[model samples]
Target: MALLTVKNLKKNYDGSPVIRGIDFSINKGTCVALLGPNGAGKTTTLRMLSGLIRSNGGSISFEGLDYQTDIRYHIGYLPQHPVFHSWMSGKEFLVYVARLANLDKKTAASRADELLARVGIADAKNKRIGKYSGGMKQRLGIAQAMIHQPKLLMLDEPVSALDPIGRREVLTLMEELKQETTLLFSTHILNDAEEVSDELLMMHNGEIVESGPMEKVREKHRVDKINVVLQEGFIPDEDLITALPSVIRTEVARGVHHIFVTDTKQARDELLQLIQAERWPLERFEVGRASLEDLFMKVVDS
Candidate 1:
């Protein structure tokens, strides 16, 4: 079931449209990634959904909530650049946020401890926010967002600023969190989305260009292509590969040949026959579908 729905969503600044009319829904208990390059209005969309900013035009519907109601009560948002009270400890900050969310003192303290433990930063709960590492601080930010046990959790570029280790830490946390709550995160990093998300919302210039389950979207854009890697210092003959009856085009980059074809079986049979006849120094050969990056480029460029 859809936990949240949007229709004709739009936003503008000084009459310049940043988010054009776009529509999508978030289903219950699924990890959805909002993907686009910078200036794609991803941040604007998230801000509007979180009720931090009002939209110029559109309607948002959350399950069990009436239209025009404050949906912020059901949403937990962690911005790209979250500010922390440097002097406060992790536990203290969370308790403070819980209190702000309208929890009583005792309940806020209990919830704060529970969340700090949940996000794997319990060991640093008493430590000052100023002393926390990037990863720990991020985990703390997540804990604060969950203080009220929101039905949906939204993160903006959760790992974009972290080091490799920090990125890995947060990504691992996200993988675990998806099992418990619906997740909506925005990212420009394709690999991270591919690794963790079940659904994708590919936006460009304030519109959703592609949106669906990851596998469905990939299959929709799949192409009949073959990749060949010759042994070191040996280059595949592009002219020879392109001459095959089934082959449409061939591109070589760093000794790897990408051959696009009209017929996969015919292309593979013909290529193998030529490789055997010419005794080509083949290191690897595989037939595959187009990658997520390739699909993103194809849609954006089109």
Candidate 2:
């Protein structure tokens, strides 16, 4: 059975709709990425899902029951920018949130340390929230969300404030979390989503533009892209390159021709052999697949 389901959900801030009739479902033991460009309603959807904000229309069900009442207890939310009591230490803050989540005093303290360590902030547990940097706070946010051991965890731009190194750390933690909890995350970072999520929901202007399993989505958007750097002054086979059944288009830029294939894969090796046999001074030849970023651009553009 699906662990969470959103059906015909609609929400508006003031009179403007941010989430317009959104609908989707997530199963247990699965990670689903809510993806979109800025102002694409990703955060709004997450907010409604977590019950931080109620939807003006439709329903959200969790474990096959109305989530607004029952499932609220089963969710953990890491907001894009977590508000903190600057006066409180990191450890204290987590304990407070943990207590508010209904954890017992002893378990709350224990959960606090576990989560702090889980997000790599154990040593800084006593540091005041105001002293922490953006990345540090994001880590704390994640810890607080997970300490309660909620069934469906939602993170909005969880790793956005981190540098590349910090991003990797958080992504790795997220990967580990998936072993035990269902994850629904929203982020502008395409690579982060690509790394941890099994599925993606691409949103635009209050609507889901596309949604599917990660590999399936990539394959759906997959087009062949290959780069060939020729031997200096080696005349290239423009007509022959385009004639390949899989080649959607070919372009020569800065002495390198990029071949985009969309059909048969038979002659890719033969084409290289032909080029090498001619000894065209090929310095580089490599195949490239469409990345989520590539797919994101194409989908949002259309």
Candidate 3:
């Protein structure tokens, strides 16, 4: 069953619509990715879902909850750039947020300690927030968001600003956290979303371009193709490969060639036959389908 339902959602600024009557739903206990390029209204959509802002039109129904009631208690939101009390230690910060969420002092402290360890930051619990690295602070932000144990968690561009090490740290944490509660995160990074998301809600120019299970989306947009890497000093038989009946187009980079085809079986047979006939020095030859990145670009561009 859908845990959250949004219908005909609309948002505008100065009489110009940014989210143009979009609709989608999130099922229980699934990790959904809100994907789009810059200015695609990803942030605006997330804001409306988390109740951070009011939509100009449409309905947001969560778990039989009334629209007129407060729903923030059932949801957690972490903005792309989360702010913190620089002077407070990680432990102090979590407890403070937990108390604000209506936990008693003892419960707050206990929750803080539990979350600090869950997020892999127990060793830095007493360290000041100001001294925390980017990754540590992001993890702390996540712990604070979950202090009340909301049903759904929302993160906006969670790892966009972190270094490689920091990015890996948060991504690893996200992988683990998804098992505990429903997660809906917005990101432009295709690989990041692909790594952890079970479903995808793709946005572009204020509308949902695609929405479905990750595998379904990839399957619907799958392309037939083969990638070949030529050995050093061997010139690729590009002209010969393009002559095949199933070949549609070809892309070459350095010694690697990507041959786009209309029929995978036919193309694979003919290409292999040519390679064997010519005794070409092949380093690698693999048949593949469109990836999430390839599908994302296609949807956004169209």
Listed per model in order, the count of residue pairs whose N, CA or C atoms clash below 3 Å is: 0, 5, 0
Model 2, 36-137: lDDT tens digits are 999999998998888778899998888856524666568999999898999999999999988988899999999999888888889999989999988888
TM-score of each: 0.92, 0.90, 0.91
Determine which window of 10 residues in candidate 3 has minimal summed lDDT.
64-73
Q: Per-residue lDDT of 1-302 in model 1, one digit per residue for the tens? A: 89999999999999999999999999999999999999999999999999999998888889998866668779999999888999999999999999888899999999999888888899999999999988888889999888888999999999999999989989998999999999999999999999999999999999999999999999888888999988898765678888899999988888788889998889999999999988998889988677999998987898
Q: Write the per-residue lDDT of candidate 3 for residues 1-302, one digit (tens) a residue.
A: 99999999999989999999999999999999999998899999889988788999998889978867679888999988898999999999999989888899999999999999998999999999999988888899999989999999999999999999989988989998899899999999998989999999999999999999998988788778898887888886688989999999999888678999998888999999999999998789888667888887788778
Pick out the ten consecutive residues of candidate 2 with the lowest summed lDDT. Answer: 64-73
- CA lDDT of every candidate: 0.92, 0.85, 0.91
Best-fitting candidate, scored by TM-score: 1
Q: What's model 3's lDDT at 58?
A: 97
Ranked by TM-score, the better of candidates 1 and 2 is: 1
- In TM-score terms, candidate 1 sits at 0.92
